[model samples]
Target: MAQIPSPYWPKGVPRALCLPQVPLTHYLQVAAERFPNKPAVIFCGSTLSYAALLARVEALAGYLTQRLGVQHGDRVLLMSQNCPQYMAAYYGIMRAGAVVVPVNAMCTREEIRYYMQDSGARVAMVAQELLPQVMPLLQSGEGDALQAVLVHAYSEGLPAQPASDEVPDVVLAPRQWADAPGLHGLEDAIAQALPAPADHPGSHDLCVLPYTSGTTGHPKGCMHTHATVLASNMASQVWRGLHMDSVFLAVAPLFHMLGMQGGLNVPVTLGATVVMMPRWHAAAAARLIEHHRVSTWAAPPAMLIDFFSNPAASERDLSSLTVLSGGGAAMPETVANLLQTRFGIAYNEAYGMTETASFLLGNPLARGKRQCLGVVTPGVDARIVDPQTLRELPVGEVGELVARGAQLMRGYWRNEQANQSSFFELDGQTFFRTGDLASVDEEGYFFMRDRLKRMVNVSGFKVWPAEVENTLYEHPAVHEACIIAVPDAKRGENVMALLVLKPDFKGQVSEQDIIDWSRERMAVYKTPRIVRFMDSLPKSGTGKILWRQLQEQEHARLATSPAQEIP
Candidate 1:
């Protein structure tokens, strides 16, 4: 298997060879040293210079090491939205030689508990609003190993607020937030903290633990070492043409791989300015970009659609944008065309997951393509393999997309069975199975056809139906549950649930009632868009629901009906 060059490669771009075997923290240290006064993070109308950002990172790293007793290789959960605190704590954990485990702030208590137990995290840095969820875990004795919790308050850093009308009034009003037993304010800890002892980790030292949902019915931790994750960081920087001068818009949540790489990690690596927004508000985002003259923005299709649809879009000066890349879902062809023809902005699309740090395939920055995951990146060997036979498929034949890259995760943490099932050795290279049904063109560009994994793509968010089904089962009325993907013109696919109620509760609950119940128990994207009552769900002889049959039936129904708009 020879390495194939991408025909879509930007003319000036050189195929990436080996990245410098630098620790992930090395990026920030280098940037701060070279340009101490340069702005490393822009948040809430305030700028954290390289010197200031590094100082905060050093402080937090010191606090974790000295006060919290976070030793090398220890997993520290970071539960927060996209904000300055997320950035400081993220790199700080790695700087102290501890692993960073980022959990979605939107996660319910049950979901948070699972992540805490699975990762065996001993400490956490959480956003102020989310402290309520993370607090219960620490108090429950179930999290005995967890010693401390650091709270990141966005209200402290936000230049001004009422960021939007939906923001809670309590959240907007100020008060004296402080430290208590097992709880510490991040700001207070940083003030008294010291720079951690110089600890240079090996290329293989695990630095990040991001959980990804798998076929095994739960989210499994993806162990990424400094060296492995660095590959994607550096490659993304070069591939997207980021420089010290680039200003990034940080709208994507930092917990996700794409945002962690493009919005935070890459900027630190290049000493670029990252304008951080704690939440996604189209108007606020547009204003920040115009005010800061942002050069790069990494986002999903949903954000793009919303940002463009904003009436303020007509007034914003987005001419400073030079790079816009996204993954999780492809930008619709018409939308991409409109962007290029009307705004002169080339949307650089990429494909990656929690497994690959963030990149494995990406559309070239120069000759960008719509709806195509670009050619295999430098130092990556991607192939379309028959899902059943595990044999390579010819160009244009759809199959599971498997890839081996420098940034690939070491393996799913503590899940040997999943590790065995997800990775296979082919041509002497160990490739991670993407679970995506796709095809590669003769030019080496890959196009997605479908997902072999039971996951739905809602506005570029991966929603595991099994996880949703598990949550739905918690409802008292649900006797049996089957979650399936329904055709959604805007979301690409949305979750639709089939439920068999307890005989006594048959007419007790409404479809809207079940939908509301499920929403509170799981992530919003995982909530069912449509809930249908069923006397009994179609099942296999083994007692498993026949998900595929139902999925196909829904496709037929949708095919015959006129599609509805998302709004």
Candidate 2:
């Protein structure tokens, strides 16, 4: 089927983009050549010019190739919070003709090990603060291919004396580490200035492998090539009207696809300045925006809520902001109204997944709808189809959303079964199943209704219940566990675990005990906020847990009860 022309498409924007067929590093090289002195990254008042950033990227690429023997198509794991070192490491890995496997900094030791082993990463670059989580993996002498670890401190990105009181204390501390065999400091790697091997990766070569959790309880990696990543990078730059002068506030985690594209990749592609934040602190964010004159920010609803709630936000001069957009969960209508009526800024909500580079559908800046996922972006063909029959649904009918576009990943890395289930042929075009239930309106805007996948949206983070349930099963007292989503006033939804304790340990294990156990075993966002003990859990004839049934009963119970503290 031909692309459906949406009447709601942004005016004057092309229906299709003529993207350059080259490696992603080409953009960085071009920017460095054109604007050598321009500030490429700004962190805690410290600036890294285009020339300096590119030089560091080249040096790190050389270290990976020469010292670590990272060859073409090799996967290099990168684990860090948002910082300047992350930017260099990301581009450097790709520059060395290796694929970047970015893991969340909050990942537990086991979670980090899984990503390193699954991606077959021979080398990893981690943040200094997160070294404790990664050191065990290197010392375990496991059969995993991991050979070298390079660590960088977040403080390396901060100025000697913080430019403002808003800078986090963690970012002010100096790097402290005991040298170990096969462990290298990031500064030492850059100082080597070893010549990088020739860049051989083309547009079609794999560049990134970002993992996404599934109902099967294991995370699957999405294989994105330079071409696929560039498609979204260029599309977002054009769609959002970002340019060389735009100063973007980077608060979203770079490991996630949205932040990787909006906060890092797009800004680098345009040679725009990026004000990097180590973590999301409302007061710090407000201060940075005012001081740096940040013009664009791609933040989730949770951050937006926090920003407006902070008393400092009202006093700060955010008049420099021109674009405010993001999507993980829908923006609350009340908060959206506050942004428009008070600040004169529209929150342009977008929809995409790890499978798609970052953007597929986004609310047009000039004509955005409240809580809507906007229209299909350029070069994308999106449709709604019945989940069971796979038949196309009519407009305004809720169904699974699917799309085929240049920005879509090649496929799930090394998971043929997942790849087969995720993509299907319809009218001679292969469309990736989004696993989201949504409907398109007459004006071509899409509205999300629900999710077909067993996932929870806590703030902006995705928590797969199966993954959390798997972690809970590791508890000594848990006999069986079922995780469900509960409504949260602040964070759209939070995880709630319904657990059946073992007969011998039933009276011994408290709800708080189980919650404490889970925190150490998984990412914080995936930790169950509420826990309930159960004598027995309902199951199907095959003894499969009836999670959906329990979820419905819980929602029904909440509907009738008066509001009470959830904890």
Candidate 3:
């Protein structure tokens, strides 16, 4: 069934868009041709013009193909914080007719090993600071398919003299390149300036494989082709009325879908300027916004909260901002109202997953609902369906939010079981199950009710409980662990663990011990902020832990007690 036209749809915006048919790199190529002297990326104090950026991209592409032995359709790992090098390497890998597998810069050695093994990526581009994590895998010969690592220093994108005191110390730190057998410096590779191989990837070719974790405890790659990614990029540009002149604040982490689209892909495709932030600092972000006259900012709720909370932000000239939007966790109603009342900027919340290439739904610029998921985006068909029966539900009835669109991933890479469970056909159209409980209002605005997946939203990061639980079980003191979401005054939700310790280590181990151990094993967001001792966990007849029960109990306990700050 066709969705009813939304009465709140923005004027002059079409319900559907005619997306470009070429590969994603085509846009960067065209942008360079049209705007050779224009600034493409602004990092710290240094800037890279479109002509200069394209030269670096093509050089890296040439080195990857000619020297690194990268081949068409081969997956290459890219692990780095947001920088000009990240952009160069990202497009370079694709320009080489290979797949770009983005790994979180914060990922532990073991986590990166899993990505390397799973993706069978032989080549990797990593930051100088993060090279230690990948070195062991290469030296030990444990990274079976991983052959070489290309290291980039953050300082490569920084100017000789300080651009501003706002530049983080980490970015200003001098390069400390390690001496390893397979480790190569990115500067050396680009200096070769080898001719790029012929472009072969088409619109339908695989371009990126960004991973998303599930109940399985392992991250699964979402296979996104050029066309699939372009869908969301084009849709976002058109829906948000973004133009070549628009200046964007690229503070969001580019590895994630949200940041990849809003921070990098969208702006580059439009021939716009993007001011990059290697790491989030409210004061630095504010100064950058003021200095560059940033017009659009794609910030998650936590960043927005931090920005507004900073006293320095108020002193900055911020009237240049025209658009403020993002979604990972819902924006607190208070924060939303504050933004509107103080800055006259509406907080436009969007909805998407890695499988959707970042954009699926968004509030119209002119008319938006507070704390709502907005409407189905251009060319997207979203429906609330009864998860068990696969029957479409009526408006206002909470059910699983499933969508079919050009932006959806081809499927989970090499995981037939996950692909089978994640997508289904309804009325001859394939729809990807979002695993989120939502309902649409009479005006066609969708509201989030709950999540069907066993996942916790820490600020904007998705922490799968099962994945965290598996890591916790690795601790010697832990016999069994159940991870659950608990209310957080600041982060919206935080991970909490209920652990059953071993008989001998029960009295000797402390909650802090487990937390400290977990920090080394998993990402910081996945580490439990609160740990509780449980003699035994509530379980089903099948012996599966009843996590939902404990989650409800935790919420009830917090409701009656004075809210405490989450450490």
Q: Each prediction's TM-score against the native?
A: 0.79, 0.82, 0.82
TM-score of 2: 0.82
Encode model 2's per-residue lDDT on 1-567: one tens digit a residue: 333466868887888899889998988999999999999999887899999999999999999999999899999999987889999999999999999998987789999989988899979999888889989888888778468999998887676787877777767778898899889999999999987777557999999999985656699999999999999888888899989999999888899887899878899989999999888788888888999999999887656865886788899999999999888666766667778898888898998888999898998888888778889888888998999988998888878999999999999888899888989999988999999888888778888865677679999997767557656766767767788998888888989999988678978989999888888988888899889998888753212467878988888988898976755
lDDT of 1 by residue, 308-380 (tens): 7577877899898888888765565556766888789988888898899987888877776667788887778
Q: What lDDT tens digits, residue by residue, belong to model 3 across residues 31-115? A: 9999999999999889999999899999999999999899999999999888999999999999999999998887999999899
Q: Please, what is the whole-model Cα lDDT of each candidate in the order they appear?
A: 0.80, 0.86, 0.85
RMSD of 1: 10.9
Q: Which residue pairs collide in model 3, if any? A: none
Task: Give the C-alpha miss distance for residue 393 in model 1, angstroms.
Answer: 0.9
| Model 2 steric clash total | 0
Regions of candidate 3 where Cα sits further than 4 Å from its true position: 142-145, 454-567
Q: Which ten residues in a row are the worst by lDDT in model 2?
A: 539-548
By TM-score, how accurate is candidate 3? 0.82
Instruction: Return the clash pairs for model 2, or none.
Output: none
Off by over 4 Å in 1: 1-4, 143-145, 158-179, 454-567
Clashing pairs in 1: 362-374
Which of candidates 1 and 3 reaches a greater lDDT? 3
Q: What is the lDDT of residue 274 in candidate 1?
A: 88
